[model samples]
Target chain A: MAEHSVTAAALTARHQTAGSAASVRRLPGFGWSVGLIVPIMVLLLWQLAAGGAWIEADLLPSPATIAQTFWAMVQDGSLANDILVTVYRLALGFVLGTAAGTVAGLLTGALPLARRLLDPTLQALRSVPSLAWVPLFILWFGIYDTSKVILIAVGVFFPVYLNLMAAIAGVDRKLIEVGRVHDYGKLRLMLRIQLPAAMPLYLTGIRGGLGLGWMFIASAEMMGANNGLGFILTNGEEIGRPDQIIVAILAFAVLGKSTDWLLARTAERLTDWQDKLHPETGA
Target chain B: MTRRLDISDLTKAFGAAPPVLGPLSLTLDGEGITAIIGRSGSGKSTFLRCLSGLETPTRGTAMLGGKPIRPAEVGFVFQEPRLMPWLSVRRNIAFGLSHLPKPERARAVEAAMALVGLSAAADYLPKQLSGGMAQRVALARALAPRPDLLLLDEPLSALDPLTRERMQDHILHVAQHIRVTILLITHDMDEALALANRVIVLRGPPGRIVLDVTIPEHDPAYAFPRDRTSAAFQAMRRRLIDALEPAPVALAR
Candidate 1:
């Protein structure tokens, strides 16, 4: 009987580190292999096009020439500095935007008064097609890092704000009833029931917010100032160096894809208890 | 620690709609399980919800052990398991026990799991469990708090026939052994007869009790998973079915 009594405490702790074994499922490994084939084929075709005379060397530099340029930039440490600056801006902007959006979304979704006061203004701002903020922001904050970072933040805020609010509002009434039965106070109900229930959709919103971060950063970097991947693109164009242009484009591609892959993996771990009998990574 | 429930003139209305249940009153002794049998939309869930404090009554009050009923003392299980998908079975059962000290809460959770035979599945998520297994976890979750009154809202209605019957037996065993006043809402007459010592038959769009029957534990007909072929069980089943039918209209001569 004593042993039986202790079992409950032990059972409750078991899943804390077990990573939700029951929800584990076989991912479509074959489909992933098939998906990889298409990208590899595309890369090979581009290489062939450059190797043959199908594309002019000066107009669309050979893949080897682009690779050489990429190595030269790497050796000089310019490539590393560019990546560092751009990624730093994106990180700082994304964190600020995400934090602000979460607070706003929580208030709006949970309280009618907050929605009435804030939602209309936010929604109106969201409709302003974002890029239109560029010139005005530059005038106000100047062409330093502040305007650029703020631009990326403006782009990120909407998706997180919208998704989190909707997700919280859409929580199941039945689950709320469960909280009522437990006689939970407002804070406990929101923390334990509303927040966890809203998380899967909220994570999806973060992915959207991050995508917009990458989008806004390109235009923000293009506007002014020095060392960044976007600057390299403009600089190569000014100098008529197609290989350098290709190097910048390739850098952006790798950075964007790898960051997204990292996010998808984290989300998969966090939401393992989700109903993913079918793999909808939605990443 | 179970207590008798005394209900008086309890009525619920939504806006301009007529009262959904009761201007009626009854008392239930906390001797064993009492099942409420009614047709769909007969305010079966509404009544359970009212007692669970999920819905407020338009009039009157319910008292447990001669005092005004506190919502905290009531436990409710819905038609579906309604478990938090992200929580393990063990955590879900421990949900209502946050008010208890850690050691006591653990003991209570273990006891509830043992009662429902779900101790082995404590680490599983709701999505991983079969329908019957999920329902058992729900039963444990409700029972863990040791409520003075437990209300079940057609908890087995979603299961297949085989699983439903199996759960019926499980409910019978749990009710017989646990000291709690359970008010069960079920459409199935067999389920009502199998589990309850007192079966309240209700009728209405504006719900009211039509017949309230009690079977003594010593009565030869009082059987767990009531014998379908038995004459006594069949007769009682027909009475409940007939009570649910609409009243006959007066003929114009």
Candidate 2:
């Protein structure tokens, strides 16, 4: 704990020296090549395995076959449509879940009455698996976009709510005292000090929620949705098309990674104050 | 207008047991500096917090300018520089001045920053500042609203010796320039002697003022380093130390 605070202090000091003009550091081309090496090697191993008939082609499609199937799907507009539908569902559910969770978390974290009345129920509810909600949701909302969206929202809510509440509850009491000394009212205290102090944690919650959001999309789509990446996976399975199945799996991987990357970049910008203080100095 | 503080029969208790501060009474001038000296757990902090309205007194009245002292009328600096890490230096300074109009608030923040020699660091966040610099920002934040009473709870104790000395001088400068009623809490006898016109020592389970010594205003030896080596300073320091020392075992029994 002492060492952590010292490092934090050092980082903040370094950030102060850098001032307001944030210098953007670009990765070298060599870095990109270094990053790609492992992926390329894995692809090569997989291709060699397929060519040598070490694995059945039907069970595990070749990278080339998956790429060809992906291209064909893209040409026919189905890949784009599937990606769009899934992304739309993911975005909408994530926003709703995050919004509701933030409100609930803030309320419970700040108010004893709210915590007493709501926290136990929410905690019990969250323990139930995300997939467990699907049957109940389908019965209530029917096997349409509503059920899928609600399922994803339910998945996203727990992580965001739990993390956000913990973050708010953990805000330094000393900092809050500073606000109180300044005569900040309840609203100002929460908005200006507490919320900003809780932001790094809130962002963590959002990132976790986003990951869960994507996970639930697959579950949601696999059950009933007919035009998403999950739907494509289900369709490929029914038709025994390993190549198409591999393409859908690859699409999910790329989409998840890309969105996570985007969230990470946003988090980096939001937490520049913290990052600048304790920058990663060595390999 | 300058505000005179009259704290009468002020006492604070945590639970039903011994009070942190016993019933104590003192009157302070509306200007210049006064330092409180005590050992650890001396209730000096409790006294300061009560004055700042951060903690409610168990019993007693603390009045400023013939009215009850409100939190708004006082600015407090804690032992640690409790600056909001997310806020820039300018924003932290401006934190209390939000009650003012936007332009006035901005001007107040700018003036406070300039007063503390932090104009160059206005846009930098707290994480970017050195220990001394962050403490300076905390001081600036306290001063921005121009409160009549400034309560400092060992604000310079955390800094390195050299930085602490420099901060002491800076605080002395601010005290003289602003003419605000200053109540500083410290364990350092030399610090109390150097910076304050009056020093009060508190010691007890239920803490009360045990000694009140006035530094001669006209003595050249009472000023900073010149006073450090002076016989008068040494005599005063000795007196304060004797007063702060615990009672003998026979006397306690």
Candidate 3:
């Protein structure tokens, strides 16, 4: 009987743990072998190709040359300054765009009249690609930080707004009924129930917006900017320095990945309940 | 304070379809468990929803303590637990008590959780709970506010048989302890017999009460899990089943 009871307890424990395992598992670590193997192989192959002069050195600088150029830029403090400028633009634009998009999304999602009035025009504006707005933004706001910020904001806005609105609208009606049964006032209902229910999708929207924010920052900075990584890339092309161009591209890739990783970590914390429900996905 | 409920001609219709519920009238002393039994699509849930103010009746009135029924006056437990996935069991119980002072709300939540035997699981999220445990949390949520009337819409229909029986006892214990008027909706006659002091049957496209019977409090045979083989228990069960059955066809005249 004792053995039977222990088995039952173990089974029950397993059942309980099944739903929480994904949430409790540590985020994938930087496993040196798994993470570095492919990149190392690529580097080795590139070294071989560069040493053999298989590809022209000017057109495609060897990894060693790019690394040396990066080191020179870092020593001169140019890389750090460029990164700071790019990061500042990205941060400012992302914040402004996300805030406006979230507010607009909530309004259109919650109020039928707001949706009817604003949604169509916003939908139409969304179709115009982020780069398409570059000229117009520069024309209107000039080539200062304002045009760059506005361009990034415009790029970030549509994804956040569209995804957030859809998420809010898609909140389960049954859960809303639970709030109604409890006599929640309109604002309380939205805050206590609808907002939490919409969080998982809302976070997805923000992440998508952040990705677009980075993409637009490149376009924004490329068109006309004295500082920032994009400016460095353009300058590298003009100066015929493939090493500098590669460095800029690598900078963008690294920045995009790290920011996305941060957002995913924040989302995991915010939507822990969702993670528990779908342990396999850990979304 | 305990309050009486008088529902009269409370009809509900969706769009152009025929009415789902009443033109039905019933009255209750508002202090004991009353189980309402019906077939699927019998509008049992609709009646409860109307009384809980989740749905507005197309016609008629439901009065509680001589006043029209309001949301605050009734607590409804849906068939599904409907606990907020993001909230812990304790917090879900305290959800409806948001208007209370923090200490008072916590006290109420603690008491409700104790009532449902869920104190150990207080901090567990809804997803962490089993189906039966989640349903108990739903009960705790409904009970926390201490509404004048509690509306249960087949609250245990989703549980496994053993869990269902356990929950039936829990419901009985809660009803006796809380002394709140309960209007429970269920299709299970045994569940109705085991938990309800009063049992009602609703039937039809325009749902109406077909039978109403009060179980004797003085009779041991009428107690929960009452000897199913006992003459008194069997007789009552037969009568309920008969009322639920369609009338026998007569010879063409």
Candidate 4:
């Protein structure tokens, strides 16, 4: 508990220092919060349209109606359950795909023979979109969660694979020469030199793959899943409840932004030198 | 402990071509720096690479301490500072010292950082350093291993004038402190004179050593042709320059 308080105090101090620093530079609270302006404007416009009878009220629900529907869903516990299911699937698919992609990328990148044999096939597979595999996946795994997870996994796999290959290949050849001079074995060379050198690129690939994986999660659910935000939207469509559909869409956007924001924050914390790219951190 | 490098009748050829180095024989006395001065494409870099075991000779051999040169036995500084971007200055210097234990490794890193005057910037990333600072880090990286032989491939050739002078002083200072045998390849005649006690000039096709001269200066200072018009320095510089010129067709054996 003492250690926790110490950490909390340190965090509070850091936050205050950063706040003062931002004000000194005449900077806003958070640079990326500017992106929220678009959604806020859209919500205002949406409220105006739904209330002003610019279109049929049933066809286009107001922001207030959507918020009320969302609150109702949350109170009943169905939205929480759906979100949990969707997040679980996304996490599982990300882990599986990232693991498989990293291993394959490292192996194929380091060996000429493996690269020659695997690259062409992986390249061909990557060109096929994730949605195109839905029918085949449904046939293989039925309308179960397994099919949705696999779809998301495949969707997440390609970005990671491509980025990892690029990272591996893009490692400075001179550093490898240094490793050779230092009598480092092949395994040592890969682990000690190549892998750490390629980490930034690998992290980028993970973030992108995670984002794409979440996108596929909703699409997969929409096609034929019994649970998730996509299922809620599909059910609402079938039952003619436009407010529930809007709430579902709003929830999807919130989940996507939340995960993305969390990943980026984690990246910033881990790779402190990369904080400069965010602008708000002032490097 | 003395380690002598003998390159005996070392000849190398590639793909049905005549040899780049042929039946070349030289024994380097293993106490101090020996500079090999040659024009570009005169195969000096290749010879150094072969000597360092980055390449294998098609014929003959290079033996270190009368033993074959194994990888990592000799530390090599390339023409460029090829540091990993992800690693900081201290990490780059300590890169090859991973074979040491934890305490020894930290000591070695500290020693290297002090030697390069980079202890203050130890936490700074490589991209944050200037070109000269990066090159010094590379030099410190090579020096940290405390190898028996330091093989340099024209390390100072790429630096600007002011940085080059500072680096030369740095190299000389480090060489004096460490007492490692250095084999430096340079086309700069003055640098060869300033840093090396013994200079060997490479000329002729299927290259062979044409001139070998020892600079008479002991405990040399960092000042350059400040006295450029001095007859002795001018005379010596002229001799080295003339030796670098192409051989006459009129002269026949």
Candidate lDDT scores, in order, read 0.84, 0.87, 0.87, 0.80
10 residues in a row with least lDDT, candidate 4 chain A: A274-283
Which rank order by TM-score, best down to worst?
3, 2, 1, 4
Q: State candidate 4's DockQ.
A: 0.21
Q: How does chain B score by TM in each prediction?
A: 0.95, 0.96, 0.96, 0.90
Model 4 chain B worst lDDT run, 10 consecutive residues? B219-228
For each candidate, what TM-score against the reference?
Answer: 0.92, 0.93, 0.94, 0.88
**Chain A TM per candidate, in order of listing:** 0.86, 0.87, 0.89, 0.85
- Whichever of 3 and 4 has more lDDT, that candidate is 3
Q: Flag regions of model 2 displaced more than 4 Å.
A: A1-29, A275-283, B224-226, B246-253
What tens-digit string does per-residue lDDT give for candidate 2 at B45-132?
A: 9999898878999999999998998888899999999988877999989999888999999999988877777777788888667888
Q: How many pairs of residues collide in each model? A: 0, 5, 0, 0
Q: DockQ of candidate 3? A: 0.47
Q: Give the TM-score of candidate 3.
A: 0.94
lDDT of 3 by residue, B192-234 (tens): 8888889999887678888899999888777666776789877
Whole-structure CA lDDT of model 1: 0.84
Top DockQ prediction, candidate number? 2
lDDT of 3 by residue, A1-283 (tens): 3423533464468566884675466446643246667989999999899989999999998999999999999999999999999999989999999999999999998998999999999989888877888898989999989999988888888888988898888888989999999898889989999899988888888899999999999999899999999999899989999999999999999899889888988888887776354433212
Q: Pull out the clashing pairs in model 1.
A: none
**What are the runs in model 1 whose C-alpha is more than 4 Å off?**
A1-36, A280-283, B223-225, B250-253
DockQ of each: 0.35, 0.49, 0.47, 0.21
